[model samples]
Target: MSAIRSATVSDLEPLSQLLDDYRRFYAQPSDPAAARAFLAQRLGAADSRLLVHAGQAGALSGFVQLYPVLSTVSLAPRWLLNDLYVHPEARGRGIGRALMQAAATLAREHGVPRLTLSTQTHNKAAQALYESLGWQRNDAFHGYTLTLD
Candidate 1:
């Protein structure tokens, strides 16, 4: 089934739900309303691009969101694959790979020099998929996070 496409405002509901599920996967509390508003804000600002995967029966099974970034050394634009989520039911069907490829294509078309993403270290499945798609794991630099609140 043709399942992937650039998401539009028409996909807001499903996209919001999927995003909330993604947050929950990271141990965040469920907040569907917050998810909706967040996505709406992002879409309205045009600061990011979201691609959706509509599985069987037009269900919104997965999505990937990209944000633009710049490589200081290269002095070229790049893409940060900020979020990627495929519903549990949609796993193992190559949707994730397809979405990654689509994101790469979009970046390349826009003259982006590279695309980058970071997944939880424990997410072996995602690592495998990314490695299989030629994504090199960054072993050179340590990643750090700081909580603002």
Candidate 2:
């Protein structure tokens, strides 16, 4: 086990692979090149933040990416935990839990009001982890997305 730390351009390759696997988990098509490019763009921009958990052998075990968004009602910055993934081989090693905790810690350190994320309703394991970590379900409002494409 290793500590979770902020990601950098140097971590691009492993990060992209992990991200690609994550997208695949959501039924996205395989596209490693696209994943690499996408992660590069995000890492280049200051718009998003990422934390990675590396294994004892220096392999990437899991990662969490956060995008900052404004909360108009609260008039404060909030973090959207847009992506979180632990490699299948790395599951149950506490990597997912560590990534989530690291993401929340980052938000708190930045003085952000909250950290938000959405996982498929079928993802009971992730939901359990979130609840165990003190993240409450947003029952007050419904979330909707309209794809332009």
lDDT of each: 0.91, 0.91
Worst 10 residues of 1 by lDDT: 1-10
Candidate 2 backbone collisions, by pair:
none
CA RMSD of all predictions:
1.0, 0.9
Error (Å) of candidate 1 at residue 91 is 1.1
RMSD of 2: 0.9
Flag regions of model 1 displaced more than 4 Å. Answer: none
lDDT of model 1 at position 142: 91
Q: Model 2 misses residue 74 by how many Å?
A: 0.5
Please, what are the lDDT tens digits per residue for candidate 1 over residues 45-134?
Answer: 999989999876887999999999888889888899999999998788889999999999888888888998999989999999999999
Highest-scoring model, TM-score: 2
